[model samples]
Target: MNRTTRHLGHRARPVLGRSGVALCRIGWLALALAVPSARADDWLTGAPLARQLASPVDVAWSGSPLRPSLERLARAQRVAILLDRRVDPDRPIELRLLDAPLADVFEELAAREGLGVTLCDGVVYVGPPETARKLRTLSALKTEEARGLPAAVSRKALARAAMRWEDFATP
Candidate 1:
């Protein structure tokens, strides 16, 4: 019995052979491995910056200057952080913690320095208490104002206007 076929002057052999079965098994295995499996901490996946801030960290500083310590933390956590000019960056700080959430550490520092900490548009802002209080409210208002625009324009405007220190400052 002849089982081969010809197309465009080329012979095509049957593919369901030993090698084909092995290929199929390999494909199934690959697919099974590629699917995302459920995790216990799946709830932590929301809001990337929030997730990063929620990460447990160990920090030990003895009279370290504020600006450099914040820069180091930002680098280590791969997150954006801003220190408002109104806040004294050169202020000496003492922080010692083991396996603490990064947000808690920021709160502690803010309290100790008589400043404020707020997360706006993915960047952590450390500044005057009044500015921090108003940042989120202003961001919400701007967002609501952009809601009527077309999706692309809205996205562009939002990205361009990512919460800046100038937005909170009144001249």
Candidate 2:
């Protein structure tokens, strides 16, 4: 087996007595129930409208240097950006935009950067919500597409973009 598979296989088999196994199974079941499963409906409905609004008092970051500001904003905005690398290839990233309609902005941004954009229901998701707005405003933004996931890029791609944004932001 490959190194990764071998490692996973080793980790999957836990050394537990019968009672331990039973307890583990019970714990897993409890967790399964506690964590709500994602459904198509959840994606469509999104967070409530009351939760969707953003406060102007929130600080805006240009990039990684300003991640603290973004994190603070997310607490109130109920929005967060998931960088492409941080997301599972199988799952769509969640995006919440406030104060602006995202359709055209997303399309233009993706095209300019040759990134991918997808819109489902009212949400516009690009790489991640954190950088999506800034990206859309870039003059370099071109035409965007509602295509399937873009080519897999590195996790560092997001860090780089965020840092760039911070650097460009006016003090």
Candidate 3:
């Protein structure tokens, strides 16, 4: 049996199944409507999106539908994850971790579903890998363009601007 769910550094595709989760119109208000028994995880790292990617999260799930699991994770982390129409919200994802960084989880999701996650402004932008790659390329181009400014600016300012856009570029 070939499993699609990726865990930690390993990667795999889901064996056989299809599902979709709609994140649209599902904000915190909607999350409150989820199953009463669902509990939220704590946000251990008090860092920005870039650093928060390495935040530790304890997850234990088995054959859980992609949508609800993700919704729970998002709520726990106090982050909003918006799903693109191209994603299958109902897809099955399995995860077991005593303490794994958020990036590892995101990578697992990508390995299983060919999805790309961009963290910014307390929101996660998820979509096809190709789309994500293109966004990153565009962001890098923007950074390069800034380097070509007619007037030479301080290294600090240029670095800050590049860092700002780099977050959006990476998954």
Candidate 4:
């Protein structure tokens, strides 16, 4: 049986062989991917984007360039946005979204620019449509993961405006 040593962080770990090393790498990749997406969603528990979108907003763009429009939206929504360099930032974009949900505005932008938008790490991304779709998928997965939240603690002091024992004291 072949064996190898891998120096990870402060300690060295052992591997059985080349295949073991590869398997270890794959396991690490999967775990690394999961941790970030899962933790990145802590901020999402409040549904920040939904809350932002739920509130009506007015937008009027008179053939303005894409960058500025995105910047404006980012400022208004207080969300960081990573723009794609490939997209013509100066390309003229026109839209009139009156008191519309934030998501609709993004969808309209995506349609006009032939681009896509995604939410990751509390940031919005505007770029290739495929990338946007992937981001949406990741977001959906994170939401699904959140659905099966850990069981509630056995005992806790709870208070609420509409407090009922049935609400908090359910097993």
Candidate 5:
């Protein structure tokens, strides 16, 4: 007798039978849940520093030096702000805002100075346009690279270790 036997396995099994379909659906669901969905404003929402940067502040600067103004703001907000060496710290800037978020203030300042601003590693970096544009991408790449290493190595890579001048020997 020539009866079709699905239990025989090999060519007898269907490509996507009940079990296969169920497994595929479960796999897709697991994948969806495993990887988080992100939005453009995720950084502002997720990071505490980012959220702090979004808090409103009343700024009044009348021909104030860039560096001192930024330092004051950083001190007040308790957030790290790094102004690139290339940018002129003593450059005078005039700004007045009743109540504006720090991020918007940074954007306006950058625009006026023809510079770029970016937040990386819980610090706001103000620098050349190209550097600002690449900072986030560079940070992401570093994080991704670290994730592939062993736990101890990854922790060391991520840690912000400060070195003194004595750590290096004269060549």
Candidate 6:
């Protein structure tokens, strides 16, 4: 046997020859189970974009004279927002929404406004008309909900409320 195998053989004598073999088998089994779990978690947390895109219903966008809150959502969810302006020159825009609620609201509003909303993987598109309506409705709702919610709930709820537009936006 080579040096490494010889060393292992020597070590195995005391362990494998005796009841210690049981310990070795248990160690290997434990390691095997641990390896797959680690791999699964890695995949789960690795890509924000993939996670976002998996559920198109989970995101939305709103456009207005005021810039869409793509940046805000991106910061919240820690994902990159890819913007493309070539599709609509009159209202060229691109942004990423990280917050699910905000995305939902944007989607809803976009639908109501008749904007062409499409979710391809993780990318969100807000057509002109729907984009405008999203801004208007959010602006109005934000003001109304501001006073009624508790501090923490208010923040999360407002974000979700803002995203309620996602439900309205075109699929």
Per-model CA lDDT versus the true structure: 0.54, 0.29, 0.48, 0.49, 0.55, 0.34
Candidate No. with top TM-score: 5
C-alpha TM-score for every candidate: 0.63, 0.24, 0.51, 0.52, 0.65, 0.27
Winner on lDDT between 3 and 6 is 3
Model 5 scores a TM of: 0.65
Better of 5 and 6 by lDDT: 5
lDDT of 1 by residue, 1-171 (tens): 211101111112332223322322222222212222311122122366566676789989788888778767766676555677677777889989899877777877877788877654444667787876555445545565555568887665544211212223452
By TM-score rank, best first, the candidates go: 5, 1, 4, 3, 6, 2
Top model by lDDT, which number?
5
lDDT of 4 by residue, 1-171 (tens): 111001000112221223322222222232212222222222231356557745677889988988777766665566445576567878898899898766567767777778876554344557787855554344434333433444342111111111112212332
lDDT of 2: 0.29
User: Residue by residue across 70-138, what tens digits does model 3's lDDT show?
Assistant: 778876665555465467777777778767777677766776677876532233556787755443334
RMSD of each: 24.3, 20.3, 12.3, 18.4, 20.5, 25.9
- Ranking according to lDDT, highest score first: 5, 1, 4, 3, 6, 2
Q: After superposition, how far is residue 27 of candidate 2 from its true place, in Å?
A: 24
lDDT of 5 by residue, 1-171 (tens): 111111110121122222322322222222212222321122222257656766788889899998778867766666556677678878898888768777778877877789887665444667798977655455555566665668997666555432222212351
- Give the per-residue lDDT of model 6 (tens digit) for 20-66: 22222222222222222221112122255445433343433334321
Q: Candidate 4 overall Cα lDDT vs. reference?
A: 0.49
Q: Which stretches of candidate 4 lie over 4 Å from their true place?
A: 1-46, 136-171
- Taking all chains together, the TM-score of candidate 2 against the true structure is 0.24
